[model samples]
Target: MSEASIKRAALYRMVTPEHICPFGLKSRDLLRREGYAVEDHRLRSRAETDAFMAEQQVKTTPQTFIAGERVGGYDDLRRHFGKPVPDPKATSYQPVVAVFGMALAMALAGSWASLGDVLTLRTAEWFVAFSMCILALLKLQDLESFSNMFLGYDLLAQRWVRYAYLYPFGEGLAGVLMAAGALTWISAPVAACIGTIGAISVINAVYVERRALKCACVGGGSKVPLGFVSLTENVMMVAMAGWMAFRTWA
Candidate 1:
């Protein structure tokens, strides 16, 4: 579009000495990036902001208006521009995929550097250990949230509430020990116990009962759908635990 025929958008945001509305600035930037000439209007005081809000009949600031029509907030502006907006209620396996993908990539890179081969037993072992550690980290980020979410479907957690809180620590400890190829007696048992419980819970919740739910494998606030991916995680842990123990014995 030419300058003379350019589209225009008005963005009203709060910019006071003490506070600035982040959404307002984002909306203005979005409009400009989308080829709209933005008319920036800063409400410099609480009184002015309140009056503007009252006039606009809006409870929030950083409101956008395009083509002389109100386009709401930053998310609303995104929608108006045909941009994708994240839905909090939606189910997705993006986090799980990301954790597992990064773990595998890191494992492969390490194997190539240390053993001169990416496709090796060490790589497989490291991938599972890395995945466990990363997943544990995510859960440990919000222990309360993870525990609450885990209680929803985990039979062990449902029966013994304290297990939910300890699960992440156990997973992390086992992963570290396994990665170091040490203390197989302790790490292997911990991994096996947790893995067995997790596998059984996943099977009961997603397969036998056929209930659709979010997986707590990633974290409590995660949108990862509970199903085959979750099942695989538990099963991998169980298999890895057995393999590590066998390798140590042999």
Candidate 2:
């Protein structure tokens, strides 16, 4: 074939209707990336395509032609070439676990009878109870999003936007509870109960997620692996609950 003929005879696949995206740019970028361009019109008539394939001793459907050689469809070629596999999701598990840890530590502190006058059970109580409550409230937003997912809707279409607002809310309440609990021993039990409930919620969420169910903890920058965070939170709740029970009975 003449160089001019070869230059104009570019390889292209007729785009099936399914090949389009929601934005209607079906595989254009992908085709461009694969050393081919999308033509607005089919390059060859069906009979001509079949004739070419018969002459080349190749199958006709979605074939590739390069330098007088039938290269086959790029998909099949890629399979032969072995494409790199990408990670399914960018797993994350930081802030959620940290919150649970902080709450549990505070709960543990409340159970320490020998903490002395500077910091008494009352102080621990307020911090634990209030912090846990704040966590529950913050998590409720995630729960709302998760529930919506079952109906084919995505919660928090963008990442970390929700957290920008919620982090302050959590910190504010946590600060108040920490201050109040530190001043009075009476607030300690309440804090422990709050913490216990929060932790249990985390655990339950994780369980549901593990069962291929919806997730309700998709909060700010929370794209990480949440199953572990959920488990840890649940254990922390149990620990806090046990500590509160022990203190109450003692």
How many backbone clashes does every candidate have? 0, 12
Q: What tens-digit string does per-residue lDDT give for candidate 2 at 26-66?
A: 22344456545444334345565566667657664455444
Query: Candidate 1: worst 10 consecutive residues by lDDT?
Result: 222-231
For each candidate, give its TM-score against the true structure: 0.91, 0.32
Superposition TM-score, candidate 2 onto the true structure? 0.32
Q: Give the CA lDDT, 0 to 100, for residue 241 in model 2.
A: 47
How do the residues 1-250 of candidate 1 rate in per-residue lDDT, one tens digit apiece? 6777988888999999999988888888888889888889999999999999999999888889887889899899899989999887988778987999999999999899999999999999999999999999999999999998899899999999999999999999999999889999999999999999999999999889988888888988978878787788889889999999999998
Highest lDDT scorer: 1
Whole-model alpha-carbon lDDT for candidate 2: 0.45
Runs in model 1 lying further than 4 Å from the true structure: 1-3, 16-20
